[model samples]
Target: MTAVALVLLAADFVTKQIALTHFSGSDPTEALGGLLRFTLVFNSGGAFSIGEGEAWFFTTVKIVVVVAMLVVSPRIRTPVWAVSFGLVIAGAAGNLVDRLFRAPSPLQGRVVDWIQLPHWPVFNLADCGVVCGSALVMWASMRGIRLNGTRESDAPAEAGATERTAEGRDR
Candidate 1:
């Protein structure tokens, strides 16, 4: 999981650097005709540029998320949970880097977003990682999968090991 997170963070960092170097002074570069393009944008807000001046608030949120994930990661008992959380943390950290040091000022730096799609908001690799990771977490929870690698159906039997009977003895 740590490896996955590191890889994702590295990838996002490299790609953003490339975008900054190559696309910063140019018009939109089309990757696919009328479908995909790379257009440099410095966003100071949330998704789709909402709340465009709230960089400090967003930075605070990212810090909380990263710290919470770090605190919880050691207890992750399943590969699935690890991967899901890793991706999320990687995504958060990627953008957090920008918010902390990229431009403007500390906790107010703008995120560099470039990838664009037809009729969709411009976004970047970090956003992709965050959305995909969150979806996986939601799917796992919906299917009654626990973070400890146990299904809900199996929990009763597992709990029996620690359960006590009315006689005050382990079942």
Candidate 2:
């Protein structure tokens, strides 16, 4: 989990720096026959630029998410769960760094976003991590996989049988 988080965090940081250096103050750059574009954007809000000017709120949320993930990481016994948590942690921390240290002042700074697709908002690698990680977490939960790597279907049959027997007697 630590490895995954660190790698993603580093990648996000490096890419954002590169984007800032190359894309800032320039017109959007197109590639892949206009399928993708590098358009520099500094967002002070949440996803899709919602709640603009709420950088402080987003920063607080990211801090809480990072700390919560770290506290709960030890109980994740499955690789999938570990990766899911790691992605989320790295994503939150990546954006948190910008909010806390970037231009405009601490806790009110804008996040650098440069990647854009047709009809889509300009976003960064950290946004990708957050979206993908959240999807994975939902998938795991729907599949009944627990934090300790146990599935709902893995529960002992004896417990179900005992419950049935008790219900029969009560009737």
Candidate 3:
């Protein structure tokens, strides 16, 4: 899972580089049949350019988020959790590349978003990784699955406590 995550991250970085150099044009170029486009737009804010021009702040926030995820990710053990963390790692690393490189230097770098849906905001591979990974984690959690890698059942303690209480009542 770590290997897969790193590979995905590397792929995201490489693809972004290509976009920066090749597709990072002054205009948005159609990559697929309108479903995809190689648009060269720089975002200095949050997802979908919510806070454009705030490069420094956003970069700092991103770094913090990535670092936090990296630190907490290793504790995740289940296969699904591992995959989810990997995807998140890929996304973080991908965007981190942009924050580290690109024009204007340092934390002032802009994110490269290209893939665009007809009705959705333009996004990139990294963004996809983030969204999918986050969703996986959320779904797993809702189903009572642990994201911390622990294999213990979620209801074990509750059930045990209930049994103990019933025994006390009987006594």
Best by TM-score: 2
Clashing pairs in 1: none
On TM-score, the stronger of 1 and 2 is: 2
Candidate 1 residue runs with Cα over 4 Å from true position: 157-171
Residue-wise C-alpha lDDT for candidate 3, range 1-171, written one tens digit per residue: 588588888878787778778875466777567677777677777796888878788777767877887888767768888888888878877887787787678888888877677777777888888889899988888777776655447445765798899999999
Q: Relative to the true structure, how large is the alpha-carbon lDDT of every model?
A: 0.89, 0.93, 0.78
Instruction: Please give, for residues 1-171, the per-residue lDDT of candidate 1 as tens digits.
Output: 798789899999999999988885268888767688898999999889988999999999999998998998887898888988989999999999999998899999999899999999888999888888899899989888887788898765655554455446633
TM-score of 3: 0.82
What total of clashing residue pairs does each candidate reach? 0, 0, 1
Q: Which one wins on lDDT?
A: 2
Q: After aligning candidate 3 to the native by TM-score, how far in Å is the CA of 14 from where it should be?
A: 1.7
Cα RMSD (Å) between model 3 and the true structure? 3.1
Candidate 2 per-residue lDDT, tens place, 1-171, comes to: 898889999999999999988885369889999999999999999999999999999999999999999999989999889999989999999999999999899999999999999999999989988998899899999999999999989977775798899999999
The TM-scores of all predictions, comma-separated, are 0.88, 0.92, 0.82
Question: lDDT order of candidates, best first?
Answer: 2, 1, 3
Q: Candidate 3 overall Cα lDDT vs. reference?
A: 0.78
